[model samples]
Target: MSTEFHKLLFEISEALVTDELAALKFLSLDHVPRRKLEAIHEPKAFLEVLQEKDMIGAGNLFFLKELLYRIHRIDLLTAHLGSSREEMERELQVLGRAQVSAYRQLLYGIAEDLTSEDVRSVKFLLQKQLPKTKLQENASMLQVFLEMEINGIIKEDNLTMLKDILQRFRADIKKKIDAYEEKKKENYSREEVRYPVSVSVYPEEQGAEGEAAKQHGKIYKMKNNPHGYCLILNNHIFRNPRYNREGTLQDGEAVKRVFKWLQFETVEYMDLEGKKIYETIKEYSKKDHRNMDCFVCFIFSHGEKDKIKGVDDECVNIDDLVSCFTGTNCPSLAGKPKVFIIQACQGSVRHPSVAVESDCSGPLEVDASPLTSIPDKADILIGMATVEDYLSYRSRRTGSVYIQSLCEKMELLCPQREDLAAILTEVNNEVAKRELEGSKQMPKITSTLLKKLIFEVPQ
Candidate 1:
């Protein structure tokens, strides 16, 4: 390795050694098996051991890069590891393709091994057939395959094969469920059942009333103008020398304009550290929302999977940010729609392009808030720029693909009295049509609401 690269690695190793808990998590995530971690104090020694033991595999490099980001040493990653977005993704692609092939084989093996005994019961099958414990082992490529399979996004043949195996398991579970219910002389509710056999299927909304229920609440109709506060935590600029998110100001301006047009009082935070971001939200959450009809928050920043970065490079989980305004945490906002528009990359994985084309807080008062919260059960809509573990594009010239399309869609649709979900669906469609260097982008929305959210001009 080059001298400069060696120096960077040494610093990282030293940092890890000093942070025992973080080191343990890192080791566990990457499966770096050693009797103890204390002996690896220097980078050179660490590299040697990893190589000798075959612990530093290609699959684990993805997590290692994320580890660098989590610890705020991305500068070291770029300087020494040649991990520019393109370079790193190229490496990941090679490893990803290989892993996919291996996982296909693994799936075949599992299919062959699935005997009648394996599907004896749902509980037993989940614990036995799927290797559930090992699935929690690391953020590996195999997990991606499992998610794709579960979501029915894999190839039809493969999906059919996987489903064939699962069908046996499901059938056996249903038999068991039937027997137990017969014994009790009653049918059990779906919610009351504890079986992994249930496959979630969302029914299509029928008619305006059904669509309206999914969009926003009946309270929206009682008010002429939307009453709520919109907070824009925009981090266009960064303290990290390696990062510069140009055109992000446009994202902030566009969101501010839209929410303001929606008649919601809006506040924008230009650049904040992670703690300050937490503090701002906490303070905002404490405010009474008795008169407000809804809440909107837009977070624009650099991010990794499940977390966005503050100007100072500290990472904050997106879940933590949204939970600050959950019903239990901010009771004043209960029964109201809380919308979060997040503009950030969710992971390091890059979509393979077949062709061509275009495209908080406050350090002064650290937000000692916990990194996670009990996810609110209802009335929360998280609009992520991209699906988890994928990149969301941004132009040095024009803002992000997702936010720009979102604002444009809202601008056009809001005037027509269309609901938020409809507009977001249009945004997703518009973004799906766009490509950057042959790579596609897709926005995702996770909503739990009982009413339609339509922002109409005040009479």
Candidate 2:
């Protein structure tokens, strides 16, 4: 047997606390005597003897397998030894639901500054964060998170929400400490006065390329200005690192440039994990964008049927991404265009193989949920790279099929007074005509536009 296999055998023995002779008797092997198994001191040798005597059968293996399975540790079995750590990762992904992950990070962040004596306070904070019933159910999970924080992995990149929560907690803690210190001081200096920082940058209007548009019995210039903000969230690296996206930065650059040319102040956030994506949107939503005209957000990341993976490998629902900016939540951008362009596979399903002379075509079924039922809010547009339940192709050399075509079409058509819907339609047609890895792709756009939004280019 290979060295890893031998090592696995020894590890399994260490995991099983039953006596060697008792374990052999439990196996109920007819050929292997309890005394002969007792002569073997090492687990590897015992396993070898079982194989040599041809005593390794399904029934005999169950004795060991059942013990491991009972503890939910079957992954430590010899056949799965090498991938045991991966099993933990998969479990964490499933366990880290969106709300749970967010709260987990928050708790982890607060726990970092806590001392051994602060355990009671930490537990109290955990209870305060959730209701009593929910806290009871998550008690064990919270213990695991506390262990992860002590190990130094909880504060890493994937748990930004936690870190951000920690930051807020730290600030409050510092304030309390400072207040206490002030009371103890007899002669303390007055707090320094700080003035607010200001900016001189103002919105510049790009003169209309042609005639003005008539609105409310008035002729308004068809000029575009930096009326609002454009957020570009591009996630490439992930906790597993295997799913790290290449050529995504190029796609983000294309989006930033196009949005900048359209006079929107483009802000780019790179390599966010699942919770941070929501947190970032929520943070941005809190900002007053009443002075701005429209809002646009672009996401380039790996996706599933109806969700996108954060760098931490957690999946977040796509509707939650848009709903963060809905008029109800973010009233500053209300009644203005809120556009989202997502470039991720809608599902795992691939294109069907076709015969040259075949006249019958089969309908494609996506195994994932439909990317629909976005809240019935006006002025929201969602642009998906592919139709429901299909993969969106990206090249290691160039960028994604959808983004490249979308940018090219936008640059070509935006100056011509084409509405965003019309421009995206052209993009869909352009992407559909191209084939990647022998599969065709068509983009999907769902919109509730109250009016036509055009990025009027300067002459």
The all-Cα superposition gives candidate 1 an RMSD in Å to the true structure of: 18.4
lDDT (Cα, tens digit) per residue for candidate 2, span 333-399: 7666888999887766665433211011123336655545764877788999987767777776577
Deviation in Å, model 1, residue 265 alpha carbon: 0.6
Q: What are the lDDT figures for the candidates, one per model?
A: 0.61, 0.61
> Could you say which candidate leads in TM-score?
2
What lDDT score is found at residue 46 in candidate 2?
Answer: 64
lDDT of 2 at 226: 73
Task: Please write out the lDDT profile of model 1 over residues 36-123, one tens digit for every residue.
Answer: 4345654556555653433333323444454454344666567655565555446445412122122243343343344534534322
Cα lDDT, model 1, residue 220 = 44
In candidate 1, where is summed lDDT lowest over 10 consecutive residues?
Answer: 356-365
Screening candidate 2 with a backbone cut-off below 3 angstroms (N, C-alpha, C), the clashing residue pairs are: 105-162, 227-292, 227-293, 273-311, 274-310
